[model samples]
Target chain A: MVDREKLYQAILTGDAKSARALTEEALKESVDPKELLDKTLIPAMDEVGRLFETNEYFVPELLISARAMKSALELIKPLLAEKGAEPAGRVAIGTVKGDLHDIGKNLVAAMLEGGGFEVVDLGVDVSPEAFVTAAKDKGASIIALSALLTTTMPAMKKVVAALEEAGIRERVKVMIGGAPITQRYADEIGADGYSDNASGAVALARSLAAKVPAAA
Target chain B: MPVSQPTIPRLEEFLFGHARCPVTCGNHLEIGAGTVIPEVNFTLQAIEICPENWADIREQYSLMIEDLCRRAVELEVPGILFEFETLPPMTVNPAWGLEITEILSETIDRFHQSHGLRAALRLTPNDTRDHRRPPRMRSGPFWEGMVEFLHKAPHAGADLLAIESTGGKEVSDEGLMNADLKKVVFALGVLAPRDMEYLWGEILSACEGTDTVPSGDTACGFANTAMVLADRNMLPKVFAAVIRVASVPRDLVAYRVGARGPSKDCAYEGPYLKALAGVPISMEGRTAACAHLSHVGNIAQAVCDCWSNESVQKVRLLSADAPTVSLEQLAYDCRLMNVAGQSREDARKLRDWLVESDSALDPQAYVLRPDVVLRIASEIAREPTPYLQTRRAARAALREINRAFEEGRLRIPDRERRWLERLAKEAEELPDREEDLIAECLPETSRETFLPEEYGLS
Candidate 1:
């Protein structure tokens, strides 16, 4: 039997090669893919998030660990799908129009993915219409918007309006985060949620996902 | 006398220099050599289409400036420095940008001539490369637009030139978020200074051609990013404080490349820049609440040469236009500092109050104290290279933070306490040579985000 402990350590330390090798080994030993994911990969990513919140691990660390977890996850994803497994949620994320800043948005997308969500990254300088289109097409339960500039922050409001116009406002939750974004701004813009940091964003997404109704 | 050309031969001269290095601008206004100048930074509520609405856009800015200058005259403020930080659309269209620049510069000139209330216009083009990954610093349309404006704005009557440049921000954004020291070093220490050296060379040539004062650059995109993140509890405050210290050497490159004093107001690291570079630094504190909230509300003003309200929109307020109200608040702040500076003892008293009020509230504010700034700056100046200076600044800040924590002057949660030790160890373990540090961090960096060749890395 494979030493499952090494897989957890590999993911924790962001050793993608070792994480991939170990996950593959665990599977060959007839280990359950769900068991490996629930017991090892998710726990490792959860700990990474915890360390991030505590300031022991920063974005670089979070990014590398997320990479490692994804590497192992890629190997297990097909098998999990064959077994009829489901992701925690589906999320659509993008940086709002006129703001080309993507580092923060990317971090949130990575964190949401690590938290077991199926994320559709919309890239930087995204328009409200594109976000609305993505929500409708991907059947995303949540739309994550980001903006770094005070000038571009208004675009976040335009997105909420677009969602309402698309008649998806009832089903799709909107969460916003960025340097200039505040809880007050989120409340004013009618966003369903706001998270100051990437780690908090994952928890916010999960809670919102729990409250969301199943896709029609 | 206001020096026609300002130059400092070495870093040692700036050790205790404050209000001793001045840059004369327009006809009569002198900043830093002595006395504080109030620089008002204002913007329209929103930018609309150009040519189609250039008339309205021009009128909006004209009214804001007219209101600001009238208030300056009424308040009996000695002088004003107006910074026109162009929004994206303005810079993208150089003709529209120059038209607005001409109007603002001509207006300030008119105000100075009529009221004898000396004023200078600082035109800061919004760095357009912000939208590009692996940024195109020396070439591309954004670069072309920026360079064209640099050459023409001075001729259009812009008296000073500066930028909140975003050269290394691609990696810097990632580094600050993850507490990644090596990435931070590369972004600020290596890439930023190199970009500053090149960009400021262009700025200096422009300044010489048009006789404009080459004002300094700010680590706004780099250090300020760390600060905003820390403020939101996304990163450790100590890391943010250390990043602020680390940014000094990077900002100093502007002076090395011939940028004269009175660096941008929003550069919160202005105090350390003033101490180490001996430049007149403009700083905004509580009054800048119009732009963003900050914890260093009082301490940021302790060593400033020019006081400022970062940027306020020209919207209606209960009492007056937002810019007018901001000017009143800033003018009062400058008046108090000027009155205090009339006597050495009185200045010290006020400086102490400014430091003590916010220093203990957060580590980010703590590092901005003049005494702390000098200590960290002295360590930075001793280093022979920008990379070493950046490393030394980070270590020195961590040292001060540790001492503060140990002495009970600052508080640290258990999580932050552990992080402080880890950061101190990490700072010490970083490669002693810049080459080795670069070699190690290169492979770790994502290639798609930035081009290593742009930074002269093979």
Candidate 2:
């Protein structure tokens, strides 16, 4: 049987190949995919999130660790589906249209995945329709938009309006961030939440994805 | 060391690197802030211009500088900080950067002539990332272009040059503060040492006479700080940007480094200073510069703090890149002492000894105490590190750097020395080479997306 301890170690060290092998081994041994994921995978990712929060880990380490987790997930995903395993939640994220920057969006996607959310990374320069469509198709609980330039920031609001037009505004939470973005901007644009960094993005995803109450 | 006279800089001198006009323009200089040093200054930080908005860009850049200059006199701003942004690739050639600088120079002169307002101008780069180019331009070529740009720039009549990091501000669609080096330079830092050695010399050449670039992954402040402080007129003129003293018995200078403020407004001020213990760092008992005040407030306070006591000694760190620039020859007599390592006292001691030593060098690097560093390395060796990557990369670079020092490849300046020579120097070895070190420590993700060419970040 693939040792749970060994699996955790692989993910923690960001050894994607090892993590995948161990995960498959565990599944082959008839370990409950749900139990293994809940016990090992989620917790390992949670630890990565905590390290990120404390500044113990930065963007590079975070990326590698997330990659490791994602690789292992590739192995476990089908089994989880057959066994009817639900993620912490589902999220769709992308850099808004006319904005080509992707580092921030990529980081948030990694963080979201690490936080146990199934992230639909829409890549950079994504149109509002793309975001809404991803959310609609994936049954996503949240849609995250990012913009760095003040000039490009207006695209975020457009996405929000698009969500309304598509009739998905009620279901999907919209979160925004970037250098020029602020909490005030988030409120002005009517986004559900805002986070300055990736770790905060994960927390926002959880709180946003989990049982969000309707506004008064 | 025989004491040299403190050449107090007039408000005009701080404009050298950041803002400049033809030196011959003299009193005819157009837009500028009023002279108020060791006091206070306000900064209108960001400048974003679209390519189509040609006249609009000039108008906006002027209006902002003029408004700030007006405030400089009214609020008594000690210096002027203009973040000349090169957004949407405003310039097609060297002349474009020069033209923009000339216009800003005229703006400063006009303001000075009309409103009776003038302070040393600090032209810092607030470049937005260029999406048109591939990630990571060649550092050598980018810096070569920058050096040529700066040469054309001196004619613009600027007094201070605050060269920013490699990549300027980037606006992401995702709303995350993701700043990264263009990945191309990553190759230069970790892989190509020869190219870095050439690029390092070029950077030092560019920063020769300028002041106020913060130490970051891209800017190595040791030499630049020394260069500006060594200038008799500039140092004393912008004295407020120097160390502020306190009532504490121990020698305490309230010095602030650059940091993303607590509120994260792309602001800088005493927040970084407030994290330190010295009283002068917390000017007006504040934790950060006013968002409205911008970085100007910090410079004003620090300048005044230093000028508060003229006789106090200072220590300025010289770039050890030059063969003659030895640790023993650096400015040890000055009041500004760079204590880089605080949490790690052992590392601090090692740095101290390197600075203090003058005679025969320790080629083994074992000459200075390296116990604390070795121990830290050992402690983190086997474990999975959640340690900050910048800190991790820095520690790794430092280890290699100390080894370089021990191997007799580098030298530190003496307690009293300054690098004053031709603008360009023969290519030399640099242990803590600015651009290379910055490129090396960048997170892999940042390196992949940001382009050095986009920001003119070399």
Candidate 3:
């Protein structure tokens, strides 16, 4: 029997070494990889997110803890794949065309990954066409766009319009955020959703993923 | 976002152009101070050099710095500021960065010893423009490097350590890229405790941070804030706020915003209008106008202008010399004084004198000093303020009753001194005038919104 509480503690405190050792030991004892993720990693990240909202934990803590969780997840990823474990959702994320701001985008990407989403980060200054192609190819449930500048906001609108021209508007949920983006602006640009912060972005991604029709 | 030279204000905004200068760019050498009149000009910006050229660039940078220092002294201006930031490929390597810092520190000591220039050097933890940093500074390695740089640089000879983040700027229209210490850096909840030769300045250009992207205190992220908070706990405080964003974090060592700035109009105009009824009454902190390419002498003139002003000088003196009043309370008092028909200059002097008088005399008795009487008398007689009608009444009431008293022209009986005190109280306690004027100037009706209710109590 695995000390599940100890595993949870290791993940919560961001103890990557203990987490890795525990996971390897748990695997030898035939513990379920999906169970570890669902019951341990996801729940720990949920607490990290909650702490962040309450101001008890900040970005540095989040980054370090997420890294710790990743250390353990790397060991479990193969087993989960062998067992055909489904990710919570697939998210294709990028900073829109002509906007190179990525701190916010990267934070959301990491948080989404911690939230059990398979993220395909398109990096900075990604074109509208690349986003549409990646969304279809990756079967991403949510297409997350980030822009830090007001000048690049029109690019976010263009990405959404590009998806529509490609005939995939109905299937994909386009979520946009950045310094200049507001929910009203999101609606104006036809994006499915907009989040102000990374934690909120995670919550929005999970909600959107649940609403995404199950893969055919 | 890119910090492009704005569309407005052609570089030829100056009264006279230097035809023989090597550079052709229109220049306004703006510093962190202001220009009082049309004759005042801007200062040269702190220059930087790429890391690969550290060895080679030293001669060029040194000669420019030496010339600038010599000229600054001749102009009687305060020392200049320059920085050595981590550039990609050459300076990012920790050992290399530390070596450059060591060399720079030695050079700084030599300059001070030789030229008596009070030039300050800033150590940036991470350059948001450094593209070569590991993607997202992966696994907080970026922060680790910064921490190492900070620990070693001060020992090497830095005058200041600005926990700077450029956020992101465009090199050209070619691409939009943002890099930050936030990517792979952790704001250590704990700062390295050290000797206090240097001060910390925050340059977090985060006026536009959204909910997801919190630029902890305007442009400064968590690392800078955490360090500031830590310094607050340490003895002989070690931080100053140098913000470049829309908002200013409330701190005692603050260089606050320009009330009207960055508009496409003038090269860079600050809050105080020189023609505000011919009385310069702004309590706004020193600010430089924008002239993207200014000469060294121009910035020195602006600094000189700001330092020459009594209001600016008084604020600097109050912050540095006196410990009785917090700067926030002083600013609050200035707002009240400005409303009460006092020019910003008199207000600062009064506040400084009040604190001095408060500390010197018996706590119970308020004795009128020569400094206090003369200041009040001069302010009452100075001008007819157009801001409010009650301002007129407030000035008139004090002027009528205190005219003889201030100049030592009145002979007061011992018993009648109480009556003179009563009239003085009346001048201060006049109805509806003060509350209305202060409320009008405030951003919010409840002062608690702009600052904490118990702001200076601590």
Candidate 4:
């Protein structure tokens, strides 16, 4: 059997090569990929998220660990698909239209993927129509919007309004974050959630993802 | 033997009896000496603009400018500098930017022509080339519109040029998050300075054509991003503090290339630029609370040549419109600084207060001290290139933070202690030479985020 501790350490240390090797080794040993993902991978990312919140880990550490986890996950994804496994959630993320800031949104996307969410990154300067279309077509459970400037912050509201216009507001949860964004602003825009950091964004997505089925 | 005070290298070379503008402008109010110039940065309130709402946008600018200029008069302010940072739509349409600039500059000129209230507009068009990483510098609609807006705004009566350029943000964003000294050094040190050389060259040529003063650039997209993340608890304040110092050399690139200062107020690195380059720097502090909250509210003004309220929207408050309120607040801050500037000893005392009030409270605030600034800046000036300068700056700042923590002069929280140690170790571990550092970091960075050719890397 593959040494699970080594795999965990590989992900934690952002050793993508080691993470991939350990996963392939485990799969060859007939250790269930689902078991490996649920018990080892998810737990490792949860710890990474914990360290991020406590300040023990920062963006680079979080990013590399997420990268490692994704590397390991890529090997398992085909296997998991063969088994008909569902993701923790599906999220569509983007920087609002006219705001081309991508780092924060990318960080959140990475963290969500690490947390086992299937992320559909809409990329920067995404329009309201694009977001509405993603929700209907991609079957995204959550729409995450980001904006770095107060000037383009209104675009977040426009996205929320677009969702309402598309008649999908009830089906899709909306969350917003960025430098100029506040909990008050999120509330004003009728976004379902707000988080100031990426690790917190993952936790927010998970909770919002849990609520999505009930709302539907 | 006692250590001597570290004097800034270029202190004696500042123009206009101090670090004021190198050339004359329509604003008659001299920056850097004699009196403090109050610069106000304001935005429109919650209103979206389309072709149909263009007239409403024009009226909004009129209301904002009229309120601010009238408030400056009512307050009996010495002079004012207005920063019209265009929104996306305005920058996308060059004519729109020019129209707004005409409205603002003409009104400020009217105030000057009538009330003798000296003022100038600093036109900062947003850099919209972020659709691609390692942004296409001088091509595409985004780049063309930005160049057009910047080139024409000055001709339309803008007296100054400035921008918070985002050239290196792609790498630096990850660098900041990872708290990787080498990545930040690559991003701010290598990529940003290269972009500034090209960007500021264009700005200088435009200014030369229009007789406009080429003001300085800010690290708002880089350092300030670190700060806001720290403030939001997404990153450690200690790391953010070190990042702020690391950015000084990058911010200094404009001056090395031919741009003159009074650097932008929001570039919290303004004091370092003032100290290292001996140029006038615009700084924002408590009055800037109208725009963003920060711990450097007091220390940011220590070496300020001009005082500014960062940027407030032209919304209504109980007393008046927000921009007018910002003008009143800024005018008062300038009045106090100008009054203190009268006596050398009194000015020192005021500077001491500005430094003392916040320095020990947070590491971010600690590095803003003039003595601390000179110490780190001195180390940075010894470097041969921006990359080495950035490395030296980060190392020197990390050393200061480490010493302050060891001496108990700066109180660091328990959670931040480990990060401080980690940052110090990481900065210390970087190779001194730029090429070696670049080679080591290149393999680690993804090509998807940054282009090697853009930064002149293999």
Mind giving the per-residue lDDT tens digits that candidate 1 earns over B348-367?
A: 78888888999987888889
Arrange candidates, best DockQ first: 4, 1, 2, 3
The segments of candidate 4 whose C-alpha lies over 4 angstroms from its true place after superposition are A1-31, A54-57, A160-171, A179-197, A211-216, B1-24, B456-458
RMSD of 4: 3.9
Q: Write the per-residue lDDT of candidate 4 for residues A44-68, one digit (tens) a residue.
A: 9999989888767767778899999
On residues A1-216, what C-alpha lDDT tens digit does candidate 3 reach at each position? 778788777877778898888888898899888988888888988898887665565464566677778888889989988998878888999998756566678778988887888899987778899999987887887899998655467788889999999988878888988866899999998988999878889999988877776651
- Interface RMSD, in order shown: 3.5, 12.1, 15.2, 2.7
Mind giving the per-residue lDDT tens digits that candidate 4 earns over B1-458?
00111235442232111453333456686677567778888888756656887898999998899888888887888777899988877888888878999999899999988888878888888877666665666677888888888778777988888888888888888788777777888888888988888888888888875768888889998888888778766778998898899898888888877777778888998777876776777888788887778889998887787888888987889999888888887787878877877776677788888889999999999998877887787788777788888888888998999899899889888878888778778888888677787788789888877777765557
Screening candidate 1 with a backbone cut-off below 3 angstroms (N, C-alpha, C), the clashing residue pairs are A58-B178, A59-B178, B262-B280
How accurate locally is residue B425 in candidate 1, as Cα lDDT from 0 to 100?
Answer: 89
What TM-score would every model get versus the actual structure? 0.87, 0.50, 0.43, 0.91
TM-score of model 3 vs. true structure: 0.43
Query: Which model scores highest in TM-score?
Result: 4
lDDT of 2: 0.43
Considering lDDT, where higher is better, how would the candidates rank from best to worst? 1, 4, 2, 3
Off by over 4 Å in 1: A1-72, A84-86, A127-142, A154-175, A179-216, B1-18, B46-56
By DockQ, the better pick of 1 and 2 is 1
Q: What TM-score against the true chain A does chain A of each candidate get?
A: 0.95, 0.89, 0.95, 0.95
DockQ winner among the candidates?
A: 4
Docking class of 2: acceptable
